[model samples]
Target: MPEPERKSKITASRKLLLKSLMLAKAKEEWDQEIVDKQAEKERYLSERVTPLHTSGLSLSQLQDLCRELHEKVEIVDEERYDIEAKCNHNTREERPVEVGDWRKNVEAMSGMEGRKKMFDAAKSPTGQ
Candidate 1:
């Protein structure tokens, strides 16, 4: 009947209520998880039993085919490296740029007009 004891009883009741609410929420989440897992299992089983739209290859056969394809791709990559090595050995001569005439050549070329136009278009409409 004392004020401190009454406050302690109220606090204890509140703690019990909070604990029960948390447990209820956890139980709901657990139930939903179980339901989702069951649905996923059913879907997987259905897919396994049903004929696929593509080649009706079994899981094992598909795995073997994937392995074979991967091996073939690796062989192709090795051959490409060998071809690249030979090509690298046979180099073509490249013309060197004259530093003195570089500025003149760049000014004469119209290739930079597109870049200038794009830059001009990106300017603020208010001209800020």
Candidate 2:
């Protein structure tokens, strides 16, 4: 016969797993929102705002427009950075150990030419 406590513990774990899955889905949605915000910012700035400015807005209007743009840009950037920081934290926490000595070579070579040499060596059979 199964223990009552064991059955309850399984139920609790199932609830936790469901909650975790929902949170992961929510994070994916938030990441998509960040991507959408970036695209909208780019499109609005390039297609709508720039053309409007070039089409002859008055100096005061342009100044006001600039202020509005700055505020919205700052807000979007702040939200993006916040979400990205959270996502980055999750990624860093979940990262696996690197497989090879690439880290050591990167540290040793720390320059463009040195990196090129390493890359060239990696491509050669003699180096292998």
Candidate 3:
């Protein structure tokens, strides 16, 4: 009887199959990571306090809290106004008078007449 044909060992096909399987496994892991991140986000949102959290407070308690918050806001506004006024006053007082003098000096040195006067002064003898 003739011997049965032996299967040829093809390393290239085996390597390709392995690479495909590894890529599939990596894709599955990436999908799971995305799912986990979405679930975590949902959990965080659910855990946050909403407006309904104050539902347990009585109407009188809520009213009193509101009144207290209004008082605090008014006090803060007054303090902020005072601070702004002081800052404005300090800024006005801190301005240097020399800035105006410097500007005048710069203007004197800029024009053609100023350059002619400068040349004349330079040409004059030091003894004069």
Worst 10 residues of 3 by lDDT: 46-55
Model 2, 14-114: lDDT tens digits are: 89999999999999999999999999999888876544433577888888988988999999999999999999999999899778877877777898888
Clash pairs detected, candidate 1: none
- Candidate number of the best lDDT: 2
Clashes of each: 0, 0, 0
lDDT of 3 by residue, 6-32 (tens): 876778889899899999999999999
Q: What are the models' TM-scores?
A: 0.32, 0.33, 0.35
Local error of candidate 1 at 46, Å? 1.0
What C-alpha lDDT does candidate 2 achieve relative to the native structure? 0.86
Summarize candidate 1's per-residue lDDT along 26-110 as a digit string, tens digits: 9999999999999999999998665435388889988987897799889999999999887776544344545596776566554
Q: Rank the candidates by TM-score, best first.
A: 3, 2, 1
Off by over 4 Å in 1: 1-10, 51-128
Model with the higher TM-score, candidate 1 or 3: 3
Q: For candidate 3, what's the RMSD?
A: 18.6
Off by over 4 Å in 3: 1-53, 99-128
Backbone clashes in model 1 = 0
Query: Distance from true position, residue 66, model 3, in Å?
Result: 0.4
TM accuracy, model 1: 0.32
